[model samples]
Target: MEYRSQGYKTKKCGQTVLSMITGKSVTEICKLLNKEESTSIIKDLKPFLESNGYDTSYKKVRTFEDIPNNSIVLLEFPDESLNGHFTLKVDNEFYDPSVGVISTYNKETRLPHSYLNFKKNPLKD
Candidate 1:
């Protein structure tokens, strides 16, 4: 019954998912384990699966060839800070839609931009 919050967690949630994944619940599989948060502690976790989880950081990357000129390459660092700007260089200017740089549309809401919406059968919002 030990749990640490903030950023990462150190706890062992009863009812293991590993055995379930492999189709085997040995009960003794993780009898004396203190698993990290990445593993499922399914019962007592907040916001179970985050639809929009973000984290960034400001890092002084080495003078790699990817650093661009004139324009700034705002990389989403590991610590989730959107306050600073980064300048990465590259042979040619490329557009990376995955990083939320060049998106499909500009929305008024904070997140889940227009391009990120996945359409299924047929339901208009």
Candidate 2:
């Protein structure tokens, strides 16, 4: 679903994730999607997705600390057993370059093709 955020910009899927990922307010996201009721569009969409064997829902925690920076690594893929493993890389240098392994069972090719570059906070020491 598409949504407006804070007035100046628009966000797609913003309404669904406003409560997630960002963990912040999404007043505009709610208005744009026109789903201000107790139930959410995401809830309706889950079953259709699951019926097709694509589990589009909450996942296990995959943190940025698991990977490194300026790296050309070929680690064993994630979300296997249900399918096969795939490769991932980090290009967004500002933060710790890490990506959550995409589930192959969710795709026909069983190959991963997307990313969410995250940074590492090393100074936690």
Tens-digit per-residue lDDT, 6-115, candidate 2: 22323223233332222334564355445553222235223322333333332222333443432212222445434322132334321111223232223332333222
Give the alpha carbon lDDT tens digit for every residue of 50-107 in model 1: 2113111222333223243322233333344443222112233323312212322222
Cα misplacement distance, residue 74 of candidate 1 (Å): 26
Evaluate model 1: give its lDDT. Answer: 0.25
TM-score of each candidate structure, all chains considered together: 0.16, 0.21
For candidate 1, give the lDDT of residue 101: 26
lDDT of model 2 at position 100: 32
Residue 36 displacement (Å), model 2 = 14
The candidate that wins on lDDT is 2
Residue 88's lDDT in candidate 1: 18
